[model samples]
Target: MRSAHRAPRRLTRRHLLGLGGIAAAGVAGLAVQQLRSGQAPAEANTSPGRAAASGAPSPSAAAGPQVVAKGGGTVPYRPGRTILGSYLALEGKAFTESIALRRRQTGRDQRIVHVFYDWTDTLPARIAGLPAGATPLVSWRGSAYSDITSGGSDARIARAARQLKRQGRPLLLRWGWEMNGDWYPWGAARNDKDPGAYVECWRRIHDIFAEEKAKNVSWVWSPNWNSAPVAGWNSFEALYPGDRYVDWVGVSGYNLHRETPDALFGPIYRAFSARKPLMITEVGSMDRGGRTKADWITLFAQWVEAHPAVGGVVWFDTDTHPGYAEKWRIDTDADSLAAYVAMAKSVRFSG
Candidate 1:
């Protein structure tokens, strides 16, 4: 991983562009100013403009190599080995210990440690406990996505933002993610009463975080890859709270049907990658075709090489849930694990 902070080298247009957003801010500022300037809830509807870890090395502590991380702070694009990450867990085990064990078993230094944070959880303590170097990419899910729009959970949400801010370090915060789908209660399929509720809720949550000055968070706006196969729902565009409100665009894509990354997720990947750095926040391949899971990993590596916009990938290591009807855990068999291990050691994955 590399620190985005660098001594100013030869200043180019790109350098100017990167320095405090003369260009990027134009778009981000539009949405921010409008959104934060106290526009009425009804009137506030609009488009927006556009970490990890631990007790280990602070970014300033490392002046040698750049370490790209997820859920930490914003990472500069390096165009090299893409970050390899995983959603690690073991029932009845402590989060930090479980994640560390899985990571060490592979003999790899994972850039991100994915975890779930429900409303009752404390974000700072959890993030701080991870293995020394891993960044926390927390999937902050509320039982209902309407909490923000309803004004029922604003306090709880605000405290979460404050907790994250209090940590005073980079952390990836994924809130009410996969809103485009209907399967989850907070998803469009059920609890999101109005189509616009998702967007409004997301914006309000983000605004509160901003109000509290929680700048250490990288707010990841994530969505499911499958189309609203259900009716009365919004598309990705409508659900999008705009670039200003978002830091990174992440997607939950899985090879449940034994398809390649491009086939299952290319459409959204293509659309969003051009606008923002992308992350396969949650991805996995099922056990299929004699060696389908392994094959998918191989193909994904190829795809990562071709797509520079893809900043990182975190594999979904959990077993298939009830609705999915697939096994996503890469360690299911020696073959699949071998494929992943080889990829981990290759130049394709960043340390």
Candidate 2:
């Protein structure tokens, strides 16, 4: 609905932040004028120029599916080249070791790292400190995922989105994650088993970002694997907010009981890959039964290479447990770290 102005595109978070951080201090004065003139920000029309020039139909107009790099930007996903990233800690201050060892082991570094911000505020500097090639994939969560919103709450979401858009580089954002599962209070079941509430909450958050014109974000809609013995089916598809509102379909699946990557991730992959880029956003192979973590890593790597629809893999780098025995940290078992490094080296990861 507005004329577009292109920000200078670059990949580094600091360089983008240097331009004027999240407040967009440098652009604010002009933004006020544009707002008074009833014009939208440039971030709103992010599709590549060729689509308009060539008169070719865009993905949304034609196929009704989305395959974007960031949320609305034109970067495409490359299967084997998707990012190899991690989130060692939710506390933004603690992941330096996660970044350090990764560089040491692979002779390279992570392409991205996961970070979180609560409804109240965020820490952009934490992400700005990542190694040269790494960027942050931030998840914005509030006190409760199911709580719809008040006027002020929407403003919080808008403020965060505006900050990210000011970062200039494309960033990954996971909002209201794992909504299909019953664990987090934000899940649909906790919100009275109302699928519409969940969908509405998601779109509400998405619409705020759009309103703020934060086109740099790539929306990752992640759901946990259906672990409930009987009620899983009713909720998985119901929670999907549709392809139009989603940038990537990510699933948080971990091997709890002697499972392979396919066994753990196949259903979610099959469910959304046809319509969007797939990501094993949060994954781990539990060290259980006589099987080693190395074997699981090997199988997971093979599956990633084989699954063309899979665009990225972000391991649950933390060793925290969910009733599993071994710490899920990649280095816990013998030769497992080596196996992981080999896997990282074997594949091509692009930022």
TM-score of 2: 0.72
For every model shown, the clashing-pair count is 21, 2
Error of 2 at 142 (Å): 4.2
RMSD of every candidate to native, in Å, equals 17.0, 18.2
- Score candidate 1 by lDDT: 0.60
Evaluated against the true structure, the overall lDDT of model 2 is 0.58
Candidate 2 stretches with Cα past 4 Å from truth are: 1-75, 90-94, 123-126, 142-146, 149-152, 227-234, 289-291, 320-326, 348-351
lDDT of 1 by residue, 37-77 (tens): 65311111122111010011222333433322322235434
Model 1 TM-score relative to the real fold: 0.72
Q: Which residue runs does candidate 1 get wrong by more than 4 Å?
A: 1-76, 91-101, 143-146, 191-193, 230-233, 319-327
What shift in Å separates residue 59 of candidate 1 from its native position after superposition? 37
lDDT (tens digit, per residue) of candidate 2 on 1-351: 000111112212221111110122223344344447664321211111111111111233355433333332332466447678876642232456656766777777877677755556652523545677565677665346434554546766776777887777777887767665545556665666676767777888889889988877788887764422124332556778887888888777665443445545655665566667877777775564333567667657766776767777887675432232346567775567877887788745543
Residue range with the least summed lDDT across 10 consecutive positions in model 1:
48-57
